[model samples]
Target: MNKKTGTAREAPFDLAAEFEGARLAARLFGGESAGSYLVAGRLIRFDRLPVGDLGLLTVGFRITDRPREKWTRRFNQFKYGQPSAVRAATRTLCAAFGMFRLDGDPRVVVVSSVPSGQNVVRNDTPASKLASALAGSRGWEWLPHHVTKDRHPSLTGIASAADRDATVDGKYLAAPIGGEPGLVIVVDDFCTRGATFTDIARAIRESNPGWEIQPVSLAKTERAAYWKGELTNAHIPDYLDAAWRGDPAVASPFF
Candidate 1:
């Protein structure tokens, strides 16, 4: 979970022990909160709030100024694009999700955002591809983006002048199609404003509103800002608050 660099250096602690603790936290809190805390502590930067031995954890990236380039580069390597740092992180995330067993040979349909025009090598090896590959062991069906090529707002709408149009155009590609509704999970490399996930979720909802679409990713870009000591407690609401305030320069494809 070393952040100075993108390396997911395994901590000396036992993963099973950590998983048990996280499970306990979720049971008491009603969802994946405990697992979220455990993940934030080891992989991403975040703090926890104690409730006896158990506690609520909030991500730490909301208040910090860590650079995204570091993460992007590291993630790039993890995708079979470089040194494979992403594989290590993916394993950690999967373990945290208790997603070890597959119900059947999963027919995986992976939907990825092009982010740039045409199919390039980098996009081919993007985070979605990496996750698809990793999950392939369990019979995943990687479905590519369903929409036409276009630039759409990230769930968080704030876009810098430096943000490239190619990046935006490639996003529409990730939208889930109406016909393929059996997808159990949707993976985005990162989520900040959550616009992308929301769009994909909306598309899924429109096609088959009942489908379960759990958004999973390696890092929450916002987590780098607020992570602090072990005793700090922030809620999911905080992240959503920021999402609501995000800009509209980045338009939603659904809009």
Candidate 2:
């Protein structure tokens, strides 16, 4: 500790936060191998990271009034600036990542883009907050990029499936890539048709082709909630085969 220079120190990892995350994961997936739900979440595969791809891992299901409903409620609070939910939420997203890190790479970079009027560094959105919390704990580092100048229409209701591709394309323009390449994870609160992941991944991949880009989400819609009421968690297990809440999107990514 440099007393004269007044260097700041990162907060120690909170055991309470870890407990909360484990509790949430257990409640959502189950007590036995809740991390089993963490799959190779490739509803659509962007690329591979290592021989063991980090893949597209996700946890839990999130559609209004469906499985993991309670989680969605907290997620909404997390979205709307609930400061308390950040750490817990982050750990849940990465509840069992140690399972992978033990064998795969431990270095992780979680990135996200925001709506207009927010820059990456100053952004305090839920995803950003979670990323910051994770960075403080593990070797994860938060790269505040993905600067979108325009606020596009949110893909919800009918727009989620109908105009998702049109809405998300070309919106996530990230800054020039610099620094060493680690596992780059582009995160979202929820995913449906993979359009959001595709668009965001497309932008990041273009900027840094060699860097492995992986998409992680807290929840993946079983189907377009607005278009149809049917949502299934079945497709998730097939792709990840070793994942949680069925993170892999077995269906075709494009509509």
Candidate 3:
């Protein structure tokens, strides 16, 4: 009787279970299990520092209505920005740092490049407002960075002359300003090309030299492409099984 198999001759491989085991494997590695991994299909920890008072600088993007504009008028009234969602996501990210007892009292900085002109750092767009509001609710201070130039996909530099991708244009302009030291986390509503973070990393590494930049998102199209490995039954279970075998490396938490 193979213990890994069931007797019904119809037992399906539990994906959620496999995922959990992998997560446990991550924990065993002394990795700081972030709450962001709770719903994320893939999780990766980029840096581990040994010190006090960590800072999390989040490069943010605007979240817009989905399902195309033709259908937008039907639900525009109910499609306003929701602060609850922003706070929940923020807490999830914060929890990840909290899990490993790394640093809880973090100073979060929200940097935006949505072209809202004016120095409305404290009171500009919804995203900035949400970030400010989060800081207020958590009793943590918020730092806002907003830029407003004639920059977008339609601009001259940053992207290809023939490039029609709006997202890429936004990223190109945003990267220069967002790249900074002290545990930076770049977040977007979704990622299609993975260029924004890459550019940010390039800028930061060029300027600061050794700072590690982590890229995070609310929703990604597929885990396999961005992550190191492909998503498969073998990948998850193999790691988990190796973890349960008391691998020394697995036991070493991220430091």
Residue 116 of model 3, lDDT score: 25
Off by more than 4 A, model 1 = 1-109, 116-123, 145-149, 152-181, 223-225, 228-255
What lDDT is reached at residue 118 by model 1? 45
TM-score of each: 0.46, 0.58, 0.38
Give candidate 2 misplaced runs (Cα > 4 Å): 1-55, 65-68, 79-81, 102-107, 116-121, 146-149, 157-160, 223-255
Ranking by TM-score: 2, 1, 3
lDDT of 1 by residue, 7-45 (tens): 565333333354466667777886536424554433332
Model 3 — TM-score against the truth?
Answer: 0.38
Q: What local lDDT does model 2 show for residue 144?
A: 68
Off by over 4 Å in 3: 1-143, 146-150, 154-181, 222-255
lDDT of 2 by residue, 170-228 (tens): 77776656766655777766655566666666677777666766666666554335533
**Clash counts for all predictions:** 34, 11, 5
Best of the candidates, TM-score: 2
How do the residues 1-255 of candidate 3 rate in per-residue lDDT, one tens digit apiece? 467765332233233353455467567765544222232222232221111111122212122323332212212222244554443344333332221211333333444323223323335444454344444443443445532224334232534422433433334323233433444444433333445445444444554554444444433333343344333222122222233233454332321
Candidates 1 and 3: which is better by TM-score? 1
